[model samples]
Target: MENRRGYSVYQIALHWLIAVFVLFQLFFGESMTTVVDAVENGQPVSTTDQALGSAHYWAGLAILALVLLRLVLRLASGATASANRGPRWMQLAAHALHGLFYMLLLATPVAGLLAFYVGDPWGDIHSLAKPALIVLIAAHALAALYHQFWLRDGTLKRMLSPAG
Candidate 1:
């Protein structure tokens, strides 16, 4: 595979779109636990909880679909060619972090669906992924900032613009 200077336009869009949806889920999804508990306990659920839970569910499904589409586009286009310009260890770490992002991106929603929709015990997995996802996102954002400001490498610019 040939290394490109940056991701394709679609890849860049998917990256940011997923980021937005993930952030939405993180912040607005707290009501889902209340909604779930209420449903299970046969208690009266508030309309606000219902609306938020519904949004959370649909947003999760959207994230899953988007992730799948992004993965397909990535595989077909070979657009994931390393753009990192750093030490060998940094490159390896970047690759590992990207892999982990994909894994959690795929697994977290599936676990959520199974836990809530299918009544499986995977909620534990979904719960655990939240903190992990937040940490990884912070690291990813900080790395992009580092590349943009400290390294002056246009790494962050690549995602902000599709000129590459």
Candidate 2:
């Protein structure tokens, strides 16, 4: 699809794509570890098991790549005007939540890479942060829905589509 004048389609797609992929990882990352456990426990590991085991690392890397792109695009495009008419404190909280999201998104996967590839202990840090990330994600999604429904504002719609 062609890029819109204000909200670039690339940005929109990346945002949602990364979101769904990350959410998938959050929910199902443990299942990926089962492949390795099966082998460790003397259970036969199928080719499919190995492939699925690799997905956790691959998906983390994918999230890193997409988030990097999203950051760049967000900076390049400049964002649309705030549709938030909420209090100043709410706005500050929103910015802080967003900043935390970006930081964790980058740090977690990089830590995973370090642990897997370099035998670093940072992998534990990423593991520890998973629950935190889930909480943040839930808050973010809830806030978006609140803006869309409770506020009856276009803020969430703006993220959904640039034309909003």
Candidate 3:
């Protein structure tokens, strides 16, 4: 792997952009579900519901695109994260968690798209993915805090600052 000194400006920008979109989705995602339920029940949908659902739909697409771009950049640039002094299992767990993050990131949006555009099992999957993602994100933040405070490592700093 071709390791760089630190994350590139584009990488950092994408990371933050994706984070914002993901948070938006997490908070406002219920709007989309509400709209879906209303449509299914043959109830009239309010303009606000329509608007929020539209926003959620577009945000999901944005996340999907941003994540794909980020993944490509990560692969093409081969910029590895900061190396920490940790046990082998800890490192493996981190890697596994990241891989799961990517998979869920990609799959969740696809499920949403299918649920909205198509319909059924996908909606259930999408619903399940939200809580799973929230858990993963919480764990990720906690791990970063652990590295920053407990380990006194530069892991969080590497993400915070584009330049080393």
The number of the candidate with the highest lDDT is: 3
lDDT against the true structure, per candidate, is 0.86, 0.76, 0.88
What's the candidate order when arranged by decreasing TM-score?
Answer: 3, 1, 2
Tell me how candidate 3 scores on lDDT.
Answer: 0.88
Clashing pairs in 2: none
C-alpha TM-score for every candidate: 0.93, 0.83, 0.94
lDDT of 2 by residue, 6-76 (tens): 45678778888988878877876765556545755888777765776588878889999999998888777
Poorest stretch of ten by lDDT in candidate 2: 1-10
**Highest TM-score scorer:** 3
Superposed on all Cα atoms, the candidates' RMSDs to the truth, in angstroms, are 1.4, 4.0, 1.3
Segments in model 2 whose C-alpha atoms lie over 4 Å from true places? 1-6, 32-49
Q: Give the Cα-based TM-score of candidate 3 against the true structure.
A: 0.94
Q: What tens digits encode model 3's per-residue C-alpha lDDT throughout 1-164?
A: 74787887888899889989999999989989999999899989889889988999999999999999999999998857556557879888988998998999999999998998888988998999878989999999999899888888778887878865
Q: Superposing every Cα of model 1 onto the true structure, what RMSD results?
A: 1.4
